[model samples]
Target: MEYRISEPFTKEKFAQLKAGDTVLLTGTVYTARDAAHKRMVEMLQEGGQLPFEIKNSVIYYVGPTPEKPGNPIGSAGPTTSYRMDAYAPVLLDLGETGMIGKGQRSQTVKEAVLRNGAVYFAAIGGAGALMAQRVESAEVIAFEDLGAEAVRKLSVKDFPVTVILDSKGGDLYSEGRAAYLESRE
Candidate 1:
């Protein structure tokens, strides 16, 4: 089923989502990649303030290209998610509620999601240009030295995503495959 979800996700809102559900997300989504993750984790370790509010916020794992004339952002697309696995649990423990990216997360991250009542959404891979259109606005919010890998604050309206992992421990990556194999029998 499809649902419309907003940023700064609440426990009640996320609890309704299950793996395999389609969602149109409308609100702010911060962009961050591997380098940014490393920095954030280091900052957390040092007891430094994060660039943005962590509680219930969504972070999109993307490194968008330079914007063309008349566009809010360039080819904004999800990068591999596993690269952030090392830092995810730490962030989740601090109240991060959502992540948008491509591919499966590590078991550690999946467990963290359940532990923290968070959800992981999979944005369509290889659809950068299409994804960029959904972004209403984008601006560098932190880590400017990282260029495309810089942290960006994006205002997205009706951005499409699918629930890959939900707080209930529902996982589409494994469940989908299981269903497909079962159907062949």
Candidate 2:
């Protein structure tokens, strides 16, 4: 089922979602790819405060292209999730509740999701132009030196995503692949 959800993802909000559910996420999302993630993790290791609040937040794994005139963002497609897997668990443990990315995650990230009552979301690949339309505003909040890979705070409206992994350990990728194999038999 398709669900329309906003930010400040509470326990109740997360509990209602499951793997394979469609989500139209509207609200504040922090943009971070592997570089930003690594920095955040390093900060955490050093007991430094994160640039933004991690608790009850969603992080989109994207490094957007240059914006055209008057647009909040450019082609903002999701990066491969595995690149951030190394740092995800640490952030999740620190209260990050949701993620938006593409491709499979490591077993560690999957375990962290369940352990932290978090959800992993997958945005469509090659749909960057369409995805940028949902972003109402975007600002660089941290890591500006990284250029396109810089961390951004984005205010989005009806940003599309799918629940690839859920708080209860359900995995859409695994289920979908298994179903596909079964159908071929």
Candidate 3:
């Protein structure tokens, strides 16, 4: 079933999501890709505060393209999730509850998600142009020197995604493939 969920999801809200569920996420979400994650992780290691509060936050793994005239953002899409695996656990442990990206995550990230009551959602690949439409506002929140890889704070409405991994350790990538294969019999 499709759910309309707002950002800053609590543990109770996260408990309601499972792998393979469709979600239309609304409200603010932060964007960061490889470079930004590296910087943020490094900053944390040095005892610095993050640009935004990590608690109850949802972060999208994306590096949007340059915007055209009058648009809040450009083609915004999910980047491969594994690239952020090294940093995700730290954020999850810090109380982040949701993620939006594409591709499979490492076992460590999956474990972190389960342990921290977090969820991972996969946005459609190659749907950048369409996805950008959902972003109502965008501003660089940190690391502006990184250009397109800079961290961005975005306000989104009905941003689409599918739950790929849930807090209970459910994984759609493996289970969905097996289910599809079984259906062929």
Candidate 4:
């Protein structure tokens, strides 16, 4: 089924998600990559304030290319999710409720999602141009020196994503594979 989720996801909103569901996200989402995640975790370790509030927020693991003229953003597609696994549990513990990226997540991240009632959504990789079209506007919010790796606040409309992992521990990857194999038997 299709779901349209708003930003700053609430418990009620997250509870409705299940693995394998399609979602159209409309609202604000923050961008971050490896360097940004490291900095944020370092700040946390030193008892510092995060650049933005993590509570009920969604973070997209992407580092878009330089925008061409007349575009709000460049090729904005999802990065590999495993790159952020080392830092995900901390963010989840800090109240981050959703993640948008491509590829799989670590078991630790999966556990964190279940414990914190968070969800993981996958955007199609290699669809950068198509994804960028959904981004109405974007501005760097922090770590400007990191260039494309900087954190940016993005306003998106009808951004496509698939629920790979739900708050209840449902995982579409394993389930889908199992079903496919079963069908051939």
Candidate 5:
């Protein structure tokens, strides 16, 4: 399903996405990894305002390498999501609706997703070259001193991803693996 972040993604729209659905993400997606997540959470704890609104936004957990000439970003791909687990619940509570990363999230995050009507999407872990093509523009949004770990606002086109975890507690990785193994047996 194709969507632009400028509008609210309805629950029905989110429900239409399942494992293996192709997505064209044509809107602003915030890039953040472990360091950025930590800072954001710290700010929240201190009662500080966030640089950008998290409500109905998609947070892409990535630390893209520097772009070469005529490129938007370099080697863009998702990092492990487990590192962001500690801070994710806070953002979720603050109305962040979607997350893009690889690997599994903690049980707490899964519960938060269910309770918050959020979804966890996964980009191919090692497909950096393929992922870079989807990025149309990139600029640092906050925490610029963090270098590659800085928060970035990425404008992407036809950014492909899979729904690894859904708001209802459905897990594609484990379920798909189980089905594959069962078929071979």
Candidate 6:
């Protein structure tokens, strides 16, 4: 399942991904936390071009702390995903195929994913130190005044993530946890 992000995602690849499937997301991923998403959606509504192409892009909702010397980013992990739900449908319609964040997405977003053939992935919410190791490089792309909320271009290597919601109405977080709880009972 190791593949570069630039490659066209085949149905086979998508099929291989399920809830809790771990992946090393390499290639270019853009950081767009709350503020960045709001601004991006605003620009889209205004009919302005996005700073980066939305087609087949992967947006990671994160606001990493300032990195120490020789580090790519500090505690780089997913933030709550629901915050970006308002903007996700628009991005999905624009051809954005992948999203990485924590927590549940709104039902509207889930419906949009089903309609658009997109996938929602989640990284460990508090595992920042572990996550930082996977990110090899980072660069700011837009909204510099937003500080950590600025959109950043991240180059990651084998960055771990789990598929939370698949394109079809399958939700991993709920099902997976329920399965574990049921087994225990």
Q: Residue 86: error of model 6 in Å?
A: 1.0
In the range 1-185, model 3's lDDT, one tens digit per residue, is 79998856787797889899999999999999999999899999999999999998999999999998899999999999999999999999999999899999999999999999999999999999999999999999899999999999999999999999999999999999999999999
After superposing candidate 6 on the true structure, give the runs of residues whose Cα lies further than 4 Å from its correct spot.
Answer: 1-12
Q: Cα-based RMSD of the predictions, in order?
A: 0.9, 1.0, 0.7, 0.9, 2.1, 2.2
Worst 10 residues of 6 by lDDT: 2-11
lDDT tens string, model 1, 1-185?
A: 99998766776798899999999999999999899999999998898999999888899999998998998999998999999999989999998899999997898998999999999999999999988889999989999999999999999999999999998999999999999999999
What TM-score does prediction 6 earn?
0.91
Per-residue lDDT tens digits of candidate 5, residues 96-151? 88899999889999999888878899999999889989998999989999999999
Q: Candidate 6, residues 83-104: lDDT per residue as tens digits?
A: 9998899998888888999998
By the TM-score metric, which is better: model 2 or model 3?
A: 3
Score residue 166 of candidate 2 by CA lDDT.
Answer: 91
Candidate models: Cα lDDT each: 0.93, 0.92, 0.93, 0.93, 0.85, 0.84
Q: Count clashing residue pairs per candidate.
A: 0, 0, 0, 0, 0, 0
Cα lDDT for residue 157, model 2? Answer: 96
Better of 4 and 5 by lDDT: 4
- Those runs of model 3 whose alpha carbons end farther than 4 Å from true positions after fitting are none
Residue 20 CA displacement from its true place in model 5, Å: 4.4
Task: Sum up the clashes in candidate 2.
Answer: 0
| Model 2 quality (TM-score) | 0.96
Name the regions of candidate 1 deviating beyond 4 angstroms. none
* TM-score, one value per model: 0.97, 0.96, 0.98, 0.97, 0.92, 0.91
Report the lDDT tens digits of candidate 4 across residue range 38-95. 9999999999999998898899999999988889999999999999999999999999
Model 5 residue 164 CA deviation (Å) reads: 0.6
Q: What is the per-residue lDDT of model 2 for residues 26-55, given as tens digits with 9 covering 90 to 100?
A: 899999998999999899889899999988
